[model samples]
Target: MSHPVILFEGVGKKFRRSLKADLLYGFQDASRSLFRRKPLEHLRSDEFWALRDISFTAGAGECIGIIGPNGAGKSTLLKLVNGDYRPDRGRIAMRGRIKSLIRLGTGLQPMLTGRENIYIQCAQLGLDKRATDATLDEIVAFAGLEKTLDAPVRHYSDGMYARLEFSIATCLPTDILLVDEVLAVGDIAFQIRCLERLDSLKCNGTTVLFVSHSEMTIRHVADHCLLLFDGEALAFGETDKVFLKYYQSIGYLDRQLKPLGTSPEIPADFAGVASIRALAVKGQENAGGVKVFTGQPVDFEVSYFASVPVDSAGLVLQFWNQADILIATTHSDTDGHRLSLKPDGGRLRLALPFLSLIPGIYRVAGGFVSAGDWLGYGGHLLTLVVAQKQGQAYEGLISIEAKVSNAE
Candidate 1:
């Protein structure tokens, strides 16, 4: 059998991002807006190339992880491979079945109940009635929402919504699995179960390709790595080597490398009306020491001084893999919770209880708002890094507590 189950031969994807002459349309619409008017995102100067001249291969049983900074085309490459987007150039060849878990329950009807959604989601995953029924109970149990399974999905919390998505997608498995940060959707316990499911599939010879900003996720599940920089392959080979290259480039090991802390470092070209303050990452317990591992608790502390009292203040933390696409993010003021940073002073801390983060360069940022406004707290606030040492293994993020299930 051919070792490579999935192969990308000189694949490239280009997007037309144009500035409309009409102030509202930006340049993209004004230039050739008459003939081609699709959203010209991922374009540079009305023409952006998300992926260009990219080439690589994954063995039949290989699990390759894609990592990168934000807007680096990590997700775009998965989309291209999943056939959601056609490559501008090059070809993609796959030897087996392909399934993607990018956005779970993307087509779910909010008005539908969980049971109904189970059917709908199963059908979406190409599962027939019989197959869905076979796995229905397992899914509900895995989701731990058997009681709420009959209720309208609209009332489900964010975690519940995520559970339904995970159950529906993984009930029936496939080869060449493509996942984009979906593992981080559900809570920690559910995430563990989901990872276990994926591991089972991997052991069964399923070839998986995952894209995420979470180094721990990739480290736990992937055996190989492909580091993407600005939408192109920066490094590809043994997962450890590629991750090392990522850390080296991001200056993770340097103690002087101050990430976006109270105030993130911004480019001179950016414009905004806000100020950021002290940003520091320290061991949750030590608060003064460096060198943190996956299980060790850590704190990404941000203290910002707001000029005016804002009703809504949001503090968003983005974890970027070596490649730069955000793998996981938790925001303080995004429908879940919002706090006010008074003119006097306010501090917001994004805590990682067990630092489930795998060994990789992790970037941090502090985005602040006061009086219910987004003037610009400080974009890309700061970056912190974690290193992967050989023979070292740690569970990604908070390891879920579990007990041995024994026969009665």
Candidate 2:
């Protein structure tokens, strides 16, 4: 009979905004827990909830993906499961040996050689010398670090280090595997290999907890998903339903575009030389409040007010998908385009010959930098809807022009 390999019941984790307050409150919570008293559920001064009333269960062979924007408690939940942090209130039950690849170079020593580090990591996971010897060659080959295995880990590049870390963590199968944002490492081929390895693990009945910013990857492997927001479990269940809820929360699937009245709250340091007054997109037949079709000539304009005349100012346009993944960026500096801003205000125009994006909603971000300093920046300031073209059925996020010829 199948059973749940991991379970969390009414889990709630709290933290404090100030370091001193965190220490003080942590002691208080510990004392209360020791005395069998209920911890305070309401917010106090200088305190915040990282995870609140989160409950979920993953049965054997089921893979659960955790996702949210930054600081949404995705990593905190994984840490609780890995025993790095304990919940303030609630219980987490695990039924087997757990392996975690939460961060790069976590269980590795800088001075230790790659070969030595592999043995050390395995030993830390309760593997003996016999088991380590059995998997050493395979691990080295999978990481493609044969020449550098004997070299100190400090000498390896980030890609090499990630490869070795991922290889070692997944080399031996365990009952539960926890991976967090480590799949973005290495080259494209290596990432595919890592995904294949995860699929293999799932086939072998390993309960997995996966976390990544890539929605496509998560949707590919996860049997279920959890969407966390503002320290609360906003949605949990099937993969598609949870993903839809997640995107909806971020206004990705909204039929009507939001009013572009004010820009997103920029960081304090990002306000100095210029202010982004407005953002507008113009297509061939559209005046510009959201919907545009593929193959249309789109002109994206950023209107800004300059406090002082600057000659070395540069503008940037970043395009992000519905999943909040930055797919492309265009920079004035990269294209050798120079901007000479006047004192009062000016509009900078970026004209696209043809918008090659497929049928989907995308978020546009605008940024202004002067003298190598970011003067103003705002993300998701404008939304665009790229409708499908009349005669094309493109298969990817964007369309590419290519010619096919036969050699006879």
Candidate 3:
């Protein structure tokens, strides 16, 4: 039987909060190791567990996505897998060559030219001169750095630096790949190229551990997902099921929206000036309904309450796909129709002439802004489902009516 390419068994990592504590712990660990004594497993006053009792496995060619809010130890887990940090406890075992794209400008020398740095990075990755030569043009082309290959990396823009780093890391194939939000660095076109490269790696049987906050990117590439919450493995399983578990446990999909005419639970900071009272969306055909068929019109309404009268307030609504991708955004001020807020609170409705959204679950978020600053905001305030009409075969997140005919 083939062995798993990546395995973690009860892994845990600890870190100190302050530099002084970190230095003290370093000395203590050194002394303990020098004396052949076991290190302390308990947390110190200034230390905390970044990862605790995490366990998972990935077989060859499987792409596993790690997701969580910031400070969830996702980056720490990737660092452990890449051998940059040792687990305080438990075991992590991996076989075959591993390449990581965790940090921007990793393995890059600012003083060296881009072309020279490429060779240095390749050598560090254990690729010999001949191998670097073979892939040199491909890397340069992929990075779109043909014109600036001889320019010093110190002069490269952030986007240029990220593109070069990504190109170098992905120029050659490896048995395992570890990525952490590196794809968010470049422009949209380059991000697409990087994703396509990851797809190519998957097709070529590379085991990948990707860490990102972008749910759409994760859902697109990952077969399995590991969710980390406060340094604990909350869920690990199929991508779809794990995502559902995450959103449900985090109350992302279970928002209990207050009925119309009721004021939102406004915080003190947002109370005096203005606040969002309630939000809702309905189909035009079936008014006040949440479900709608593709190509149908939908009405979005947001109610607001103001302690004092205000002029020229902005109301914005954003539609996010199930994958957490922001599909569309509409602003009331964009069309030069700035809304005025009433002290007693009032509802404003915006209509979409043609929904054009594909069949899928969607989330709506609202924002209320006055005099440039946001007075109040709510996320995941409303959920809407768009279903495909019977006997209709449509593909993709939105439908733009296209007329197709053969010129021949």
10 residues in a row with least lDDT, candidate 1: 283-292
Colliding pairs, model 2: none
Query: Model 3 segments beyond 4 Å from truth?
Result: 257-408
RMSD of 3: 15.7
Ranking by lDDT: 3, 2, 1
For each candidate, the alpha-carbon lDDT, in order, equals 0.67, 0.77, 0.78
Shift in Å, residue 23, candidate 3: 3.0
**Better-scoring candidate (TM-score), 2 or 3:** 2
Error of 1 at 3 (Å): 4.7
Error of 3 at 271 (Å): 29
lDDT of 2: 0.77
Clashing pairs in 3: none
Best by TM-score: 2
Better of 1 and 2 by TM-score: 2
lDDT of candidate 2 over 1-408, digit per residue (tens): 256899888898877789889888888888998999987756678866688667789988889999878888899998999999988778898999888888787778999999899999989878899999998999999999999999999998888988998898888778999998887867988888998999988888889999988988998889888877656665677787677656654656543433442223334435467767777875322112265656767787777888898777788777766655554567788878878888888887888777776555567776787666687777656766554433334443456655699989
Per-prediction TM-score: 0.57, 0.62, 0.62
**lDDT tens string, model 1, 361-399?**
455543654455444554455554443343444333323
